[model samples]
Target chain A: MKKVAIGIDIGGTNSAIGIVDEVGTVLTRGNIPTDRHSDINLYIDDLAAEIERIIASTDVELDIQGIGLGAPNGNYYNGTIEFAPNLRWKGVVELTKLLSERFNYPVIKLTNDANAAALGESIYGCAKGLKNYIMITLGTGLGSGVVINGDLVYGHDGFAGELGHVCVENGGRECGCGRLGCLETYCSATGLVRTAYELLGKSNKPSVLREVVNTEKLTSKLIYKYAIEGDALANECFRFTAEKLGKALADFTTFSSPEAFILFGGLANAGDLLIKPTKEYMEANMLEIFKNKVAIKPSELPGADAAVLGASSLVWKELSK
Target chain B: MKKVAIGIDIGGTNSAIGIVDEVGTVLTRGNIPTDRHSDINLYIDDLAAEIERIIASTDVELDIQGIGLGAPNGNYYNGTIEFAPNLRWKGVVELTKLLSERFNYPVIKLTNDANAAALGESIYGCAKGLKNYIMITLGTGLGSGVVINGDLVYGHDGFAGELGHVCVENGGRECGCGRLGCLETYCSATGLVRTAYELLGKSNKPSVLREVVNTEKLTSKLIYKYAIEGDALANECFRFTAEKLGKALADFTTFSSPEAFILFGGLANAGDLLIKPTKEYMEANMLEIFKNKVAIKPSELPGADAAVLGASSLVWKELSK
Candidate 1:
C-alpha cells in the first residue's frame, strides 16, 4: 500500500485537490468550483463531498495520512481561515475542525498560499538546502513568503511576511489594500499596465502599444510582447517596474537578510527582461555588507504543479517534524 | 553549587564581563578597556587574562559552564569576528577557540552586540514570552536585531538585520557605509546633529542652535534641550527623525509582523518626545491589517546592565534550546 496525503489549494474562484506522496509526487488530482454562498459551512460541505468522490475513484490502495490546505487569509497558528477579501466568507471559519471530522485522520495544517509556495520551493524546488530566502509571487497582486533561520517566519500572529504591502514610494500610487504607494501597486502585472498608460501620457512614442491603447485593451503579456519587438514605451515600462522592485527588495534585504530571492507566478515568466534590471538595481542599492552576496533567481517549479505540491508538502513536512 | 556562564560584550572602547545565573542575574561583573593591538592574538590574550582575574577575585562558589562573547562583527556560525571597522582587528579572529582553550570547557556562543541585546530582551526584559520583535539601539550608531519565530534572524552568512542601512530617502544624505540616504544617517544621535545642521541651512527659524553650526559643538542632548525650550527647528528635527523611523518600522512590520518594537540606548531617554511621534506616525502609515495592532515602546532594561544581561541571556537561551 502507498502512503499519501491529500493536498488542497483553495482559491476564491476554484479549488484543487491532489494525492501527494512523501517525495512531493502527485498521483491523482481533481478540481471543483468554489461556491460563493454566504454560509461557509455549506461551502465546506460541498468541498468535502468532492474530496470523498475523488478518493473513491482512485484505484491505488493508499493510506491517507492527513490533509493540508492553502487559502488566502489562512492562519497557521489557529487553523482558521479569517475574512478573506476576495472570498464571500464574512467571519472566521474553523476549517481544520470541519475537514478533520470528514477525513477521519489529522487534517494536519494550513498556511497562506504565498507561504505554501515558499514551503514548496524549500522542500522541492530551487530553494532546496537554503535556510534563508524570500519567495515572491507577482500575480494579480504581489505576495511574498519569508524564510529565516531554516523555518518560516510566521511572526507573532501568523500574519508576517506581507511584503507586497510595504510602502515603496511614499504617496505615489493607491493600492487595493487602501494604502498609498505599496510595492504591489507599482510592481505587479496590473502595475506594469498602469506604468505603460502613464508612459503613454508622458511621451508620444509611436509604437504597437498605441494600437492596443485605441482598442481599450492592454495586458502585461501585450506590453511584454511590444517591448520584445523594440517598442520604446513598453521597454520603459519594464525598466520602471524593475527599478521600483529592485529598490524595495534592497530595503527588505536589510530586515531578513535572505540567501536569495526566488520570483514566481505570471510576471516572472518575462525572464531576463525583468530579472536583469532588477538584479542590476538591487545590487547597486543594497548595503555594502549584502552586496554581491545575495542571489536573485526565478522559480524552478512547474507552475501547474507548484500550488498543489506546495499545499500538500506542508502536511508531509509538518508530520515529519 | 550553582552553574553559571560568563558573558562578554566587547565594544570599540570598552568591554563588559559578567557571571550570569539561569534567572538572568549578574552575580558579578568587571570592565576593561578594549586594547586595540595590531596582532589579533595579543587582544585575545588580554581578554583571557581579564577573565581569569575576574574569576579569581570572585568568592562565589559556582561552576562556570561556558562562555558567550558579543562583539561588533561576531559571526555565530563561524565563531569568528569579521572585519569590524571600529576595532583594530582585521579579517576573521577566532576568539571562541581562544576562550575555550583558556577555560577548558566548550564555549557555546555567537552573535554581535545588537543581537545580544535582542536576546537579552527576549530572555529577561519586556519582550519576554514574545516570539517576534525588533530591538533598535540608538547609540553612537543605529543598530538593529530582528527576532523571528523566537530566534534571532541571522540570514545566510550570519549578516541579517542591518536595519540601519536601509534607505529612507533616495539621494538624500551620504552615510558612513557609502550608501545614500540610509536610515541610520538620519535617526541616530550623530544623525540628529547632522539634521540640525541641515535644518540650519534650509530654515531661518531657530533659537540657540545658530550659535552651534559645527557638528563637533552640537550634541543630541543639547538638541533635546533646545527642543524642550520650544525651538521650532529642533522640534522639527525630532519629528523628522521619528517620521522616518516610524515609516521604516511600518515597512518592517510587513516582513516580521512583530508584537512590539523595543527601543534602547541613550537617545531612547528622550522618552515621549521621541516615542509619541513614532507611535503616531507608525500607526498612521501602517496597513489596515496592522493598524493599532503592533506596539512601539521603550526598553525596560537599564542601559548599563542591558547589554551584559542580554549577552548572558544568550547562553541560557541557547542551553535551554
Candidate 2:
C-alpha cells in the first residue's frame, strides 16, 4: 500500500486539497471556494469532505499518514489561524483541531504557507541535504521561511521568519501593513509593477512598458514578458527590484549565515533576470567574511503544484522528527 | 566527586581562566597576559598551565568535565581562533587543539565570546528557561548572540549571529570592519562616546559633557555619570544610542521574534537609563504582533565574572546535549 498524506493549501479565494505520496507525487487533488464560506465550521466541513473525496479517488490502496495545512497567519504551536485578513473567517479559528476531528490521523500540522514551502524545499527540492537556507516566496506580497540546523524558526510566538516586513529603506515606501519602507513594498510581484510605474515616470525612454504603464493590465508577468522581448524600461524594473532584494539578503546574512536563499513564486519565474542581479548586489553589500559565500537561486519545485507539494511535505518532515 | 569545567576567556590584553562547578560557582581562577605571547603555541602552553594551577588549587576531589574557551573570532566547528584583529597572533590560532593535547578531557568546545555569554545566560543567568532570546554585548564594539529554540544559531559555517554587523543605515557611519552604517558603529561603547561628541559639536550647550568633549576624556561611563545627575547633553547621548538600538531590535523582531533582548557590557550598566528608552522605542517601531511582547532587560550575570562564567557554562550546555 502506498503511504499518503493529505495536503491542504488554504488561500483567500480558493483552497486546494491533495493526496500526496512520500515521493512528492500528487495522486489526486481538488479545490473548494473559500470566499463563499463565511462560517468557520462550514468551511472546515467542506475542506474535510474535499480531502476525503480526493483520497478516495486515488486508485492505489493508501496507508494514510496525517494531514498538513498551509495558510496565511497559520500558527504552528496553537494550530490556530489568527486574524488573517485575507481569509473571510474573522478572528482565531481552530483549523487543525476542526479538521482533525473528521479524520483518524495521528498528527495534524499547520504553519504559514511560506514555512511549508521551506519545509518542502528541505525535503524534496533544491535545499535537500542543506540544513541552513531561507525560502523566499515573492507573490502578491513577499513571504519567507528561515531554516537553521534543519528546523523552521517558529520563534517564541510561532510567528518568526516574517522577513518581508524587515525595513529596507526607512520611511521610503508605505506598506499595506501600515509600515513605511518594508522590503515587500519594493520586492514583491506588485512591487515590480510599482517599480515599473516609478521608472516609467522618471525617464523618457521609448520602451514597450510605456504602452501598458497606465493600463490596469500591468502585472509582473507582463513586465517579465516585455523584459524577455528586450524592452529597456521593463528590464530596468527587474534590475531595480533585484538590487533592493539583494541588499536586504546581505543584511539578513548577519542574523543567520544560511548556505543559500531560494526564491519562489511569480517574480522568481523571471529566472536569471532576477537571480543573477540579486547575487551580484548581495555580494557587493555583504561583509567581507560573507562575500562570495551565500548562494542566491530560484526555487526548483514544479510551479503549478508547488503550494500543494509544500503543504504535504510538512507531514513527512514532522514524521521524521 | 564534584564535577567541574575549565573556562577560558581570552581577551586582547589579558586572558582569565577559572575552574567552575556544575552549579556555576568559580572554585579557583587565575589570569595570563595574552599580548605578551607572540607565538600561538607559547600562549596555549601558558593557558594550559594556568588552568592546571587553578584546578590544583581547588580543595575538593573534582571530576574534571571538559574545557570551554571564549575568544574573539573563535570558531566552534573548527575549534580555532581565525584572524582575531585584537590578538597579537596574526593568523588563525589552533588554541583548542594544542590545549586539548595537554588535558585529558572528554570534550573541548570553543565559540565567540558573545555566543558563550548567551550560553551562560541560558544555563546560569536571567535567560534561564527562556528558549528564545538575544544577548547584546555593548563593549568596545557591539557583539550579539542569537539563541532560538534553546540553541545558539550557528548557521552553515558556525559564524552566524553577527548582529552587530547588521546595517542600520545605508551609508551613515564608518565602521572598523570597513563597512558603512553597521549597528556597532552607532550602538557600542565607543559608539556612545561618538554620539556624545556628535551632540556636543552640534550645539554649544551648557553642560558637563562640554567640559570633557574636547579632551580624550569623554566615555560612556562619564556620560552615564552626568545623565544620572540631570545633564542635558549626557542624557541626550544615552537616549540617542537607545533609539538606534531599539529601532534595530524592532527590525530584528521580524527575523527571530525573540522573547527578550538581554543587554550586557559597560553601556548596559546604565540599567533603566538605557533599558527604559530602548523598550519604549522598540515598542513604537515594532510590528503589531510583536509590540509590547519582547522585553529589553539588563544582563543578570555578575559583571566582573560574566565572561569567565559564560565560557564555563558552555561545557554544561554541551554536556546536557
- Return the lDDT, model 1, position A67: 86
- The CAPRI quality class of candidate 1 comes to medium
**Candidate 1, residues B1-321: lDDT per residue as tens digits?**
678888899888888998887777788888877766778677777878887888888788878878877888888888888888888777788877777676775455868888989888887788888878999988878899998878888888787888998887778789988888888998899999898888888998845788765444789999999888888888998998899889988888989899999999877889878988998989888977778889977887767878887777777877777
lDDT of 2 at B13: 97
DockQ, per-model, please? 0.78, 0.79
* Candidate 2, A1-321: lDDT as tens digits: 999888888999999888888888888889999887799988887877787787778789999899889999999999998889899988999998898788879769999999999998887789999899999999999999999999999999999999998888867788888888889999999899889889888999998887776665898999999999999999999999989999899999989999999999988988899999999989988987778889987888888788888998989998998
Per-model TM-score, in order, reads: 0.95, 0.97
lDDT of 1 at B53: 84
Q: Scored by Cα lDDT, where does model 2 land? A: 0.89
Candidate whose DockQ is highest: 2
Residue B44 local lDDT, model 2 = 79
Q: Against the true structure, whose lDDT is highest?
A: 2
Off by over 4 Å in 1: B24-27, B212-216
Clashing pairs in 2: none
